[model samples]
Target: MFASDRLELAERYTELLATEGVVRGLIGPREAPRLWERHVLNSAVLAEAIPDGVSVCDIGTGAGLPGLVLAIARPDLSVTLVEPLLRRTTFLDEVVAELGLAHVTVVRGRAEDLHGKATFDVVTSRAVAPLERLLGWSMPLVAPTGATIAMKGQSIHEEITQARRFLSTWRCGEPEVLVVGADVVDPPTTLVRVPWADPKRIGWPLARDAKRRSGRRDRSSVKREVS
Candidate 1:
């Protein structure tokens, strides 16, 4: 937290991962250091896209990347990090407390189970799942005119291309991509937004799995997200 630049902050994030032994427990020892570049920096890129005063919900916020990082970077917005794992959820709660972050809430539950009571200005998550599923679980939480920013790597273009079917069917708006942190993040990234959709979309990423099993849902199934 005391680090000045992204370079140092990334180092600090790595140091904390090792010190906290979170690397060993959550992502395994081999992958922890890489998290500095892969996760933290990747998540931080969303900071620039965030609008002021927006209350955001980050689904599957394992280590509170986009959500926690966004909250730290933008004090004007409120961030809610949703993670079901108890230990991870506690870790986020503790980190927020330690950082003295004034605007963060770590919720423990599967994304599909939590109904945000229709109270978020923005919804954000990183590779939490396929676009179709992620939208289903996330779109409902978005404010009527609110947006969902789905973070994906450079190959996101492929998913974005394929996701149009769902976007159009759901009546969700256009998609967007951003290439910030070009040097620090791999495959670069994109921030996709679905402007307005059915008020309560449930069973998103979760449904993707089920759809696969029955083959009942596919590119065409993307439409039914409303109410």
Candidate 2:
């Protein structure tokens, strides 16, 4: 499902993950044997849920799991890999440069730090945190009309149930569970898709504050122009 150039890049990425990724403790050596199926392809399959030509931010992108994989599989996307650790971001930056992925940006910061600073059409995470805490960190990064997708394990439904209170408070629509890559990858990949609801109804404090700050900045600019 990838172009020739992208296919080559994916191959190189797999090799890097198996070698340096393991040596650096980014990935366990045991995982190297199944890196293609379990890690690279598993992450790549999530591309099925993402639309073409939209911006995406992958939170806590250690070893670039789904983030770099998505950039390889779908060249149409503009991807930002948000990682907090210096070692992980270092790895990600090198891989992006090596792959010549012009559309990918490696940002060294936690998701919470980006709130009000940036937002995207879609926000993503894999094995980041529990659904409740994940929503707290991810929801604020998604545009009002966007969605947050988490690569979850089999207990996805239970997590959703537990996150119901947070979901209601944040005005998130009902979470949709999806099994992607049914044909290409064995056992498929499970995902939890949470679309954003009306912010006014949900009472999103950060978004409101951001809006007010933006308005103030605009007014200041107008005053400077008048002066």
Candidate 3:
């Protein structure tokens, strides 16, 4: 559907939220503000960056923003919403079941313990923590060929730099700021975050490459991944 007009997808997404009630029920408490634009689209924006026919995990997937939405949008991509909070996990499971979304799994656990338990082609995270700390959680859960992406705002440049030390420790790939697509036709919004993880920091250089390309498509990276 993304290959088609994105506006149609946005309309469907609007209806998807209104009828399903996952985003509001899971997030947007009476105390919290700015639910729709901040959390929903922020999470959904990842849908554009994710490759087809891959497995993705959302660490601290509180209400299953990008994770669940992407799952609904791309059935071919297997998605796992990993939320340590029991209430959130229960809410996520119920949402998946009610929505009848396929290839979407709910894993109730933390990133630290998930090591050796399972891995994924990609990992999406937001509101988790700093870049380096997020790396510890995300890197352990991704396949060697996959990468970990954090949804960030404000300080993309500093986060990338701070993530450098941890990237060295994890030997993860490079961290880059990609884009988060919006429903509007405005200049493509940037994911402005990091995509990293791999052995000996092979993903190291990918950080800059992804930044330079702004998450559109990296022929060299894809070619290397195939070889």
Best by TM-score: 2
TM-score comparison, 2 vs 3, better candidate? 2
Q: Which stretches in model 2 have alpha-carbon errors above 4 Å?
A: 199-202, 208-227
TM-score for all models, in order of appearance: 0.75, 0.89, 0.71
In model 1, where do residues sit more than 4 Å from their true spots?
1-14, 21-24, 183-187, 197-227
RMSD of each: 9.7, 6.1, 9.0
lDDT (tens digit, per residue) of candidate 1 on 33-94:
57666666677778667787777879998877678777766667767777878888777767
Once model 1 is optimally superposed onto the true structure by TM-score, how far is the C-alpha of residue 88 displaced, in angstroms?
A: 0.8
Preferred candidate (lDDT higher): 1 or 2 = 2
Better of 2 and 3 by lDDT: 2
lDDT tens digits, residue span 77-144, model 2: 87878887888888998998988988787778788877766567789999999999999998877777
Better of 1 and 3 by TM-score: 1
Model 3: lowest-lDDT 10 consecutive positions: 211-220
User: How well does candidate 2 score on lDDT at residue 154?
Assistant: 95
Q: C-alpha displacement of 57 in model 3, angstroms?
A: 0.7
Residue lDDT tens for model 3, 156-224? 678778767776664655566775575632333455433444343443332222322112133123222
- CA lDDT of 178 in candidate 3? 70
Cα displacement (Å) at residue 17, model 3: 7.4
